[model samples]
Target: MSRMILRALLCLPVLVAALAAAPSPARADALHVGLVIPQSGQFRLLGDHVREAFQVWDADNPGAFGDIVEGDDGCTPESGVDAAAAMIEAGVDIVVGFLCTESLAAALPILSNEKIPVMTLTVRADIIGEEAARLGWSFFRLAPRAGSEAEIAADAIYRFWADKPFALIEDGAISGRELVEAVRTRLEERSLKPNFVDNYRPGQATQPSLVRRLKAAGVSRVFVGGDRSDLAVIAAEAEHQGVALSFMGGDALHAPEGELPLPDGTMAVLASGVVPGPEAEAARQAFAAHDMIAEGLRIPAYAAAEIIGAAANRSDYGQTNLVDLLTGTPFSTALGPVTFDATGERQEPGFVLAILEDGKFRRLSVDDASRLTGESQ
Candidate 1:
């Protein structure tokens, strides 16, 4: 078996042990979890998915939570603070949902002041991540910090395009530029640098000039920091001119297919959330039972419930420090094993490489990644 697979197997039993720490009276003293998600806003559908996952988990394990207090964050600052206050007033043992950074920013301090630990399923931003440590807040993030996405994209490119002449191009937008800069910096740190670097206007119909420039630079491999549409246009232009180029992109490529289909062998760097492991497959099966697709924060919300409820059991049902247990233990979920570093950031295996095969991106293992040769035009 693969080392990761074996490690996953070992982690499962530890989680099973922790969740089973408390016995059948579990239904009586189960943790009172406060569900804080945006129930009345634009992102309400996302919150609904989280709630459904929680319901599924609750039904699957009858004694996991004694009661669930609903708090509507509305994905806004005012609502987040209101929700936090409401949960505190309700005497919730723990809070377990926050979808947006605005909500976390507004509510974490209040929750922390009350000594209530939060397990945020999403809400990953650099400022929030810094504040959590600088202010000593009591929330653990299952989602990765913002810049890690760029770092993961760089890792994938360096893995497959190390020796090949590769171009790092970006759309002129701030976020796209920042992404390319981050990727460039990471690769340069490892003594690898792109052969060509340039900025192209986003939302262009075609990128013939950019394709020709890349061809002139003698680059066959490219890492794009742009929207899905721009990347698709670039690839289409490259093929139209019969230029042999292989493109790698970040998560923006996960959007709905555009007018021009992404050519085969196009790769994307995705968070491990999308990585289909044995654990994730089981979650998918369960989600299928509920007719849910397990996208975005949905599965993570379910995993958060598993971690928090099981952590309460690991503790003396509130006698032990919940943060200490969460920080110190490696909890397993249908998504995979969850462990965090001292900074409260998740550890390695945070991202996976995915390849566009037959019009869809499929997650790849580390070994699966190393064997790839850049796709021929």
Candidate 2:
């Protein structure tokens, strides 16, 4: 009995050694990403596109994401807070998507406290810039800032209408007024100025008097602060009165559902436009497969997913270290090479200028806007 006891004790150490040598059950390699998007309300369309883009990418690449938690922000600041809290409860390592500016602003501090990195797929340029500056490095934006949009818009106006006498008009909305001011400031920097500047009441049926005012001012071109619909009345009155005028607008005119039927030669500045490249091929194919239109938030959402997936694959994606892993790496995404500038914004072209031709928006070359619009090159 004593000999048997000794042999058993000796074999117990050998068993322990064997157990230690064998690999433990493989840890879950999948990463969890939270999607905070509007599932209802006016912004639901944007959230749906963002969700589809992320799902398509995940499905195409098997085992990339372990679990996806969706929190509907409903495009409201209060809902944003709730959504962020829900994501934290779900044990999400990172968050992607917050289409509304207010929603994103409300969710920032909550997500930041949990150290969960957020990749914004929407364009609230100024909000992102301000938050990033104030809070250090928790936010990563894939879209252009408002100021960036304004700067590009200003450049677009100068490129196309520098030699022509143009008028600047706004609908009195703060955004519209700011955009006009941006363009006007850029023009003045070049020793040029608008022939006329004024604010017109929006939603008016006929602006015969405003048209006559512009005609008398001898302005051949007009830069509107709002969308095509904002200037539709003025444009009709101008055409009826035999006033030959061209129109220009900001990003609102690049509406995915199509802009109001502005006349030919009308142009709008977009923060970004799809340019074919190797990186964009997969998403283009994925979108085409489902007959899903890839516009606005779709491309940006895909890019955001690619960024998080890339970061996860490159490093250990455990919860407390995700942000540290994403800081300095240059992520190659469908939107092309993406690297956050010092302000945590993507470094790329400021904007794209598209002209309405035959009732469609066409990509306009930057060489000169005048030649494209029947003005002297």
What's the TM-score of each model vs. the native? 0.88, 0.82
- Misplaced by over 4 Å in model 1 are 1-28, 373-377
Could you tell me the lDDT of residue 254 within candidate 2? 67
lDDT of 1 by residue, 284-375 (tens): 77788888888866777878778876876663554566677778578888668888766566665556678888998888756555566443
> Which RMSD does model 2 reach against the true structure?
8.9
lDDT of 2 by residue, 22-100 (tens): 9975543677999988888888888888889888888777676888899997777898899999999999988888877
Instruction: Provide the RMSD of all predictions against the true structure, rounded to 1 decimal.
Output: 9.3, 8.9
| Pairs of residues clashing in candidate 1 | none
Error of 2 at 98 (Å): 2.2
* Cα-based RMSD of candidate 1: 9.3
Highest lDDT scorer = 1
By TM-score, how accurate is candidate 1? Answer: 0.88
